[model samples]
Target chain A: MKIQQATLHHLATTESTMDVARNLALQGCPHFTVVVADTQTGGRGRMDRTWHSDPGGLYMTLVLKPDMPAADGLKLTFLASLTLAQTVRRCCDIDAGVKWPNDILVKEKKLAGLLSEMQATGSRIDFVNIGIGINVNNDPARFEPGATSIKAATGATFSREGLLDEFLGALKTGLQNTSLPSVIQQWKTLAVSLGRPVTVVTPRETVTGIAEDVNESGALLVRMSDGDLREICYGDCFHR
Target chain B: MKIQQATLHHLATTESTMDVARNLALQGCPHFTVVVADTQTGGRGRMDRTWHSDPGGLYMTLVLKPDMPAADGLKLTFLASLTLAQTVRRCCDIDAGVKWPNDILVKEKKLAGLLSEMQATGSRIDFVNIGIGINVNNDPARFEPGATSIKAATGATFSREGLLDEFLGALKTGLQNTSLPSVIQQWKTLAVSLGRPVTVVTPRETVTGIAEDVNESGALLVRMSDGDLREICYGDCFHR
Candidate 1:
């Protein structure tokens, strides 16, 4: 659905957008609702991990109802990753690529990431909340060894509102275009893991292989050491 | 951590376990926390969709920390489903089975389901909130066409507290046995989809295949009509 109007919250740095959005969603907020923070004192990523949100960074979460089944919720992560990459490219001249599932990277350094939450009622999806954290103008030194900011890469600072508008616009368009072939093509254009050696780490085991392209269902294709191609449905990929 | 000392809410009815758990979790509640309601007025499954939670039903959500990567958070759904099946058997003396990804079934009717949410800081999973809904002692008329209750199938009325305790006990044991092989074995024993004709419905498309078995990482393996075995990472499965 098209977002007619939205609200923005510029916090000096609060706890987390997920926490805030969860509260709002429970309170019966309308669809396409959004919450953006300047910095998050307790910024978090997927899996309950902490994200350091320095000043001048972009942290936001949008509450939406796509009226889709809960099973298709994973696609929102791909859509968010593509939107973030496109937004980074628009805000800064440097091209940003997506690192499977959700991380957006600029040449191996992380630029942005996304986390999505959905509440399902029986067999149908009720609403989806997509949270994103982008390193727009934050200092690179403030992050871990693998993280990088847009300013650090391109020496440019983008207005957070402008970036949010573009990101949300792209996300709306991406969600509307739900055809598998089209989404896969768009993801391929922004995917950085294709044709690269990557190590997929999971709680059970680790598989190191050459990163083949992603499939229509968003599974990563990895050509294993034994010359057998393995499709990884869910795992964290670490590019070597 | 062992849940030696905990306050368990064994309510005859409530709204939603996720809502109650979120309130408690936000109040700095300790880990191994639990909330069990016999009936939920606003019970939710995934994607914020409503579910039927009549009186004498089982609606609960547990708050816990597994201290793993955020990406492996989906495993909580598997662990919870296993615990649910174990609890249903122990409480009602009826053989219950698990469907891939989430649901627990008994004689072709769904008896229980699971929904998991994780709080992550960057890439590390902090804590996972797993919400489960089971049709315990409710009447058959309370459910939709495809749903089943424990009383309807077994003609038994289970104590809500007894089932909650059993589920929590099984969950604790499962979490302690972090070995993937052991968990997979337990899951396989409780799974009913093995070697069955099932229709897997995804948001993008539907695939009708024979359910083979769950792989090492807890994904369902389906043998398609084209003589190809497809691994379904995530989706809702229905018995045909």
Candidate 2:
């Protein structure tokens, strides 16, 4: 399951890297298998929302078979985000922060969004396919109002391949060294949502509160106006 | 949707009520659509394990479109288990208790099991289909060693349809009255896992500890031998 020994599938265009990676994983593909697509016509984020995966964006899905419970599936998402933020800081010298759940932001503009899907039986996860769409050399602002690319943020074009390689390497190292406890701590350090007045919208209900912190299990702890705490596990969070 | 107003599709036999209910939901079925089967050729529990859904058992799937985030999905399972436990207590005077995740036990013998599946995009859940299999008059002991039926427990044959009707009515009432906060409390009251030494088996890990409590988000809290508390969101638990 080492990244260095993982199989790499490079495609010029695909409907979605998530779909391809899921297929490969179900077909008994090796762990840490990487699927990189130049563009995705049917790329999707959480909730089946379309992701504008243009030619210059880094559209990829990492297939991982971690020796962990399905309840800990979000660990991979947190690790990927931490690595991506560190990779941006080290490579482009640009400060990047993670929004709760899966968005990577640079100065409040989204630089990347991650969507992770897992196939599990009961509480045991068979494989987790993490689809990452990073705005690299592409101009994402044309489609999304709050979006920025590495080139747009830094005013310099960098190799997308180099960025991906750095992230993959960092992710491997993070996976090796970081346990669930440390992953949460490292994620909090790069998080931008804490200590902000936020509105979270789920399908059934909405809650408005000050984002206090994220609990150990990755649920967002929000302090309401009444001083009561609401723990949100998943939703679209808007900073007020 | 009201239970009385729900569209109940009674089948003589099916591969699984979950598959039928999922298809109906995808085909734009209304909320609270129920699919019930006399038996299933391919009944499954958590982790895709087979469930012996023989004739005379109450096999059904309830399709709900709750206006809640996908994070609140487990609340439905909790509600279902609580409602079922109450239904059994009132209908047959058999004391039933819920095990963590989704199991119903009567005096340490499993009487039923629940499996829930949801289709959602982002954090918005379109629908959640809850599959329930309750042994009524059927003898499940032949298929499952640690199984019991209402008949087996009471030595009295009961009508399966009557049991399903009672459960559905109770479930609809529970859904209407129970919020996420109260659901956790109610679930805890009927839970038999808490305050017991248990072993939980996931796909890649095994955790053994004293089951402490379930959090507001429906995660089981286990105190390890080292006195470290671990929150397990999903796993198969065995009382030790």
Candidate 3:
């Protein structure tokens, strides 16, 4: 779907685009409407955690109306992460891979992240708010020790609009391919977890396994050393 | 856990509480911080649809840092719905029940709803923004035919703070019992769907069945007239 509308906030970066988009959506914004800010004064990741989105970075949220079940909504994040990784490669020629769930990484350093929110009435989904922050033209020193920007990793700086357009375009293409299994295949090719020793952390406990692959529903399949395959639907994975 | 620090935005409504909570969370806000708005100028429901939250209503979002997996985040909605339903019952003698997934209803009319957004590092949830809107003092005639407010149903005027306090108290107790199976029991008791003939609507198709029960992970079990039992993990159900 072509972006129905794109509202760019030049120097008026707030802490969250989800807020802006929520308001916009409530005001009857069409699907694929977008709110992009040059920087976010208060940027956040999943779980109410802080995400560093400095000036010259990409902070935006896309408003989508996918007439799908709420449980299938998570698939949008997977599609988005893949689109972002592919966009990074196309835009900067950097080797970008997905770090399971929704983090985009370049050679073990984080490049971007995706957070999705939805409004559902009963089982029918109404609208989805997808917030994405990419470390674009920001200085590498601005990020934490584990984070890396495209400029830092590839020493290449692209216009924020150029990167956003590429990502949005890729996202549209990805969403058009609604076949979850096919999308999972494309994601596997760009996945950084497969065939790697990893630690999966949940609130209850941590599980160590060899990252195998993801299923059609986007659940991670981890192979234990004892040759047991575990389907982990949710948790954080750390490279061991 | 006690609400360590709470932020109330009376009449300080927004389009999305998730956005407000996300901003607060990024600003190093303490966990359990709550943001409540008397009414939402831009209220949203599931699937990117507009929620009609007029003035004198209860619209709030809580920021939480739960040490739990992202998949388990759905439980927060269940718990919050229960709290809201229970709070309604406490505030008025109205019979409020939980509709499967995330709705609080009085008889067949919806009184409140829950929407959860999360930030995740991997599988573990980093933080969650739980947004809820209750039709407290709004005139029932002003709402959609399917919607009803507390004042409309019980003929009682409630101070927003009184309702918030009750909701927070109930939420605190509900979150303490987070085990999926145990909560399912509480949900069953409060459920208005069980044993009712209902129509389940998905994006792809619709199925009509008798609402049987919910499983350990909160998936609904529907018994078809064909003598087949189907487990519906997600979908919108309407009483037939």
Indicate which candidate wins on DockQ.
2
With a 3 Å backbone cut-off (N, CA, C), the pairs that clash in candidate 2 are A46-B122, A47-B121, A47-B122, A121-B47, A122-B47, A204-B67, A204-B68
A1-240, model 3: which lDDT tens digit per residue?
A: 123325443446776888888888768777788888777778888756788877867888888877664555666777888888998898799999998878898889888888777654433345778889888888745558788898898777788877787787778777878666787788889899899999997556678999888888688888998999987867678898
DockQ of 2: 0.18
lDDT against the true structure, each candidate:
0.75, 0.83, 0.76
lDDT of 3 by residue, B63-105 (tens): 8777765556667777777778877887788899999888888
Best by TM-score: 2
Q: For model 3, report DockQ.
A: 0.13
Model 2 per-residue lDDT tens digits across residues B1-240:
123646899898999999899789889899899998898999987777898988889888999987755545667878988889889988998988999988999989999999887654333456788889999999999987899999999999987767777888878778876466689898889899899999987655799999999987677888999999988867789999
Per-model TM-score (chain A alone)? 0.92, 0.96, 0.91
Q: Model 2, A26-82: lDDT tens per residue? A: 799988999998999899887668999998889999999876554556678878888
Model 1: CA > 4 A from native: A1-5, B1-240
- lDDT per residue (tens digit) for residues A145-167 in model 1: 88898888987787777777777
